[model samples]
Target: MEETKDVRLALYETIMNLVDAGIHAIDEEGRTMIYNQKMRDIERMDSREVLHKKLEDVFRFRSSEESTLLKALKTGEESHLVKQTYFNNKGREITSVNHTYPFYYKEKLMGAVEIAEDITKIERLIRRNHEPHTGYTFHHIIGKSKAVSEVIEFAKRAARTSSYVLIIGETGTGKELFAQSIHYESERSRGPFITQNCAALPDNLIESILFGTKKGAFTGAVDRAGLFEQADGGTLLLDEINALNIHLQAKLLRVLQEKKVKRIGGTQEKPVDVRVIATMNETPYEAIANHRLRKDLYYRLGVVTLLIPPLRDRLEDLPLLTRHFIQKYNTLFQMNVRGITPEVLTFFHSYRWPGNIRELEHIIEAAMNVMLDEDMIELRHLPMQYRQSGHYTPAAEKSPLLKDRLFEYEKQCILEALEANGSNISKAAEQLGLSRQSLQYRMKRLGI
Candidate 1:
């Protein structure tokens, strides 16, 4: 009997010590009886200090009646899967999801056991990793417009150095794509590429998130390396740099200038070898006029500025972009969408794409989803907004003078295609599905 009891005790201790969850239990009298190593680490307490102590003695609780373990012991009721935030004896706030259960033996209450899963680190990581779409590089950029070409060429040169790059463009112009391309092409390609939007988090938390945090800095803060440290030896893209308040921008400028960052509450500055790329959706001049961006910080970040033009400004790339999207959706949707009809192409060219490439992509994706059996996208397959736009007229509303209307429509299509293609006759002819000689003759007759 004695040997069996010893074996059971050893097994229980081994099992409790090996489990990752923090386990704490108290006797019916509320005295601590089983406080495992995991629990000690979670609570930041020593076994010697807490063993056999009353639940209200070792831990600081508002009241003994409010203690979870004691409440379970007193009422024999259970509290399962509850999230709690409370300070430990060391004044460190511990956020844990706990299950406090009252165990019974032979219809008598034995005690209460609380199993805690710490989720503090998980919460922090989720906040820091909120940014999506880090996979796009320069190769993902699909436009061959002069504007896009200039930006790409400048970005390629910028990638050769570790200098700070500023990408200025309207929203949906793929600024982050350019940033990632620069990182992948640069010496820091092998290093991590981390991104954080300045406007995503509030000003209070952005500082710690960008720099770092010391253990005793905040109520629940642990010693953590911020985004700068996380992206050390690599590239960090700060999207919407103008969104950051002026004070934070000053601190960011300091880090860029010194190549080092000091944690929010720490005195020592740690050296970081990081290349930063800041992007702004609005022009820096406008941002400065609005007082949303700092002048000094703008100058520091604009050492290499790459401007991405809006899709409306480079209408010539519309046909190319449309074809590329069709091919992309063909593979993704497992359909045989060959191309868009000329009517749809004309409509696309006439429409002012305010939302830029992203909007164009969405329009194409929607068209593909609606077109099931068709190989070509027609006006009806497009969104309602497109079908009702001035660029598209209903077939029923056609004028009685068919020849004149046809000639007028043909001239308009040729003119728009030529404009979109930057007046390149060959490219415009290809886009309009006409031979170069035929396009030239038509242009001569139409006086275009």
Candidate 2:
């Protein structure tokens, strides 16, 4: 009878191995009793290496208290199609959907069996077809200063090439916006353009997401093309590339050199036609010194490097940018706001915008929201931080006499009244308890 039972168990294992999906069954003690070839391939493990090992010993679960197989066995509950993302023993990340069910014989509980399907391929396909398109062009970039114009010209030249490009700039200096413009203006604009932020994902996952993965390469892994393949024949923007670790940087350099990628568990390399554009928010040397970015990879990607000028360095373009944003917000908010006050412009010029153009746009949009029927943006609508800086004040040059200060204050009140009254001299004068002629005379004398 025991020999017959052993033969039956071997037959069951053979049948399970023939199935197309990953199948793993553990005894009541969580020891691997039946792990098929497909499971070995899905996990990129040798069947002989893991056949008799305990589940926890093979794959380190976060905690024994939350083990999925353990829970299913103990509670006699079935876990159906639970999607999970985790790292295997070798530190390769795997994303898969699993179904864990309790095994039983007649009325006697046996163990737990799990069936898993890797979804990495499905996700890549979805991203390829569903990613949003970038609609910006060179004309959308607003700048006229020599410093900015030079950067724009260089970017246009870089866009025409198929070589790798790198953009260096401070945060909020529009690095990604410039990248999008490059893609839209390039010859490959008709093809798909995909973007991936290197710093946004963890190191183990970023590599698989970039270079693709092969079946049996890691636990719960399936064959799938990564971002490189997804962006084939198009542009691939790797934002914050310095965030990738050194080990991964070496791997990336290989891909760039060969123009081919071998999936994490794949043995054969696949050729890909992709134009890469990398962006760095910090100085490249700093990243190298900190050991975040590899020097060789930097040389490869910096073939067409473009550095964007910060707002402070190109103050000459502030007026043009201000008008651009004002018109932008006017149409967006459906308001006919004319322009900003001269006092506000003075403040904008004198103040150091640490956040660059992004900060300026925020300030303008916030001020526009509070216009209250006034056609022009005023000093009071400005943020308190800007107002407290005293940069916009005429008193910055020299303190005025008491009479002169009073005259200036009176002039400001008259100007505000006129603006609030829709530039009606009679209404403004009435609000100020004066005749229209008196208000006009004050305006002329004070240069309001």
Candidate 3:
């Protein structure tokens, strides 16, 4: 019993230490009980300095209620993905998104646990007030389908003028690529080209980041130019513009109309010669109907709208995309992979690529990793998850034949066995009551 308890404790400690997010828990008395390695990294604190110390001693918050853990402990509440900025014991400002929860034993409040994902680096990068650059151009985009060709033509036309352009497409459909292509193609190509994703920063911080902040605007505010000022005489790419709040959208519209911006706490308006290009992962009408976006702002921004087609809608270009990715990986991996098999191509067409072009590239990369001494990518070389997904059914088959069903069942059983045995062929074969060679043969036959 004692040995079992020791093993459990060790397992618990290992799991906590291995997690990506910071884990900080305190007792009801506000003394630290658990502070994992990730938490130490995020706060730049040593275990000796924090463990068994009072929460208030190791960190500084404006008020007790400002501390998510303390607030949860006192109010018995849970908060998720709440953005917080506070000072550590060493006076370093740290920003993070925290999920806090209260724990109880027999209806009595015991303590609180907080999982924090540090975003201090991201905040610092945005505040650096440096001009951003994009290497992608029209030549970088790879597609030959009519849908792709039409969008490219429209984007080039949008590039010729200084009008605002809005790009609409699903995630991973290369919306940003088009934005960059348009920027580089425009006459403002010589000036700065800055890009910001509206969904990345918190609401309270994004306003200051968009419009310049005065030194006395807030506690840590510095006199800095925002993206609009930074992109003067150039292009500003606001990716996922719909993610901005309605109030911010209105401000953006005003900036576009007047070609000027007022700092968050400044009196004077500064003129900016910036061509704005925005992108969204959702349809404009749906976003407006849901009140996530303003219709008037949409009209002002979408002076030249470009809708990029998803990969599934343009499967005719899959062959070109496949060849491009294959060549890319061949150079990166230093392998002489010729191309994918016709069977794999058939499966590609049948699969509904929800992730679009990005997913296809990833699939090809994964297959190449396991392709040993093979010039062509085969079905067995594909990722295990892709093979297991029902999307791998042949495009010609409306209903799976009996042979196909049996093959799928055998492949599933083998996959399960391999997974259970940590992908060890000998161990998996033993579990399946077969010799290793026999199992290998079966796996090859089933295209696992």
Per-residue lDDT tens digits of candidate 3, residues 216-335? 676445577888998999888898999998999989888987889999878899999999999888776568769987766765676677878888778898999999999999999999
Say which candidate scores most in TM-score. 3
lDDT of 2 at 334: 94
Model 3: lDDT equals 0.85
TM-score of each: 0.62, 0.63, 0.64
Q: Which ten residues in a row have the lowest lDDT in candidate 3?
A: 397-406
**Candidate 1 C-alpha lDDT tens digits along 1-448:** 9999999999999999999998999988888889898888887888988889887776665432277787789899998666666666677766677789998989899899999888665455545564444566678888888878987988899989998898877788788889989998888888888888898878977888899889767654668788899888988889999999899998998898789999988999999999999998877766877999876576567667777887777788888888888888889999998888898777776776668888989999998889878999998898887776573443333223323433564577678888999999999877755568878988897888
Off by over 4 Å in 2: 1-96, 102-130, 390-448
Candidate 2 lDDT (Cα, 0 to 1):
0.80
* Model 3 alpha-carbon miss at residue 82, Å: 26
Task: Between candidates 1 and 3, name the one with more favorable TM-score.
Answer: 3
Off by over 4 Å in 1: 1-136, 390-448
Q: How should the candidates be ordered by TM-score, best one leading?
A: 3, 2, 1
- Tell me which of candidates 2 and 3 scores higher on TM-score: 3
lDDT (CA) per prediction: 0.81, 0.80, 0.85
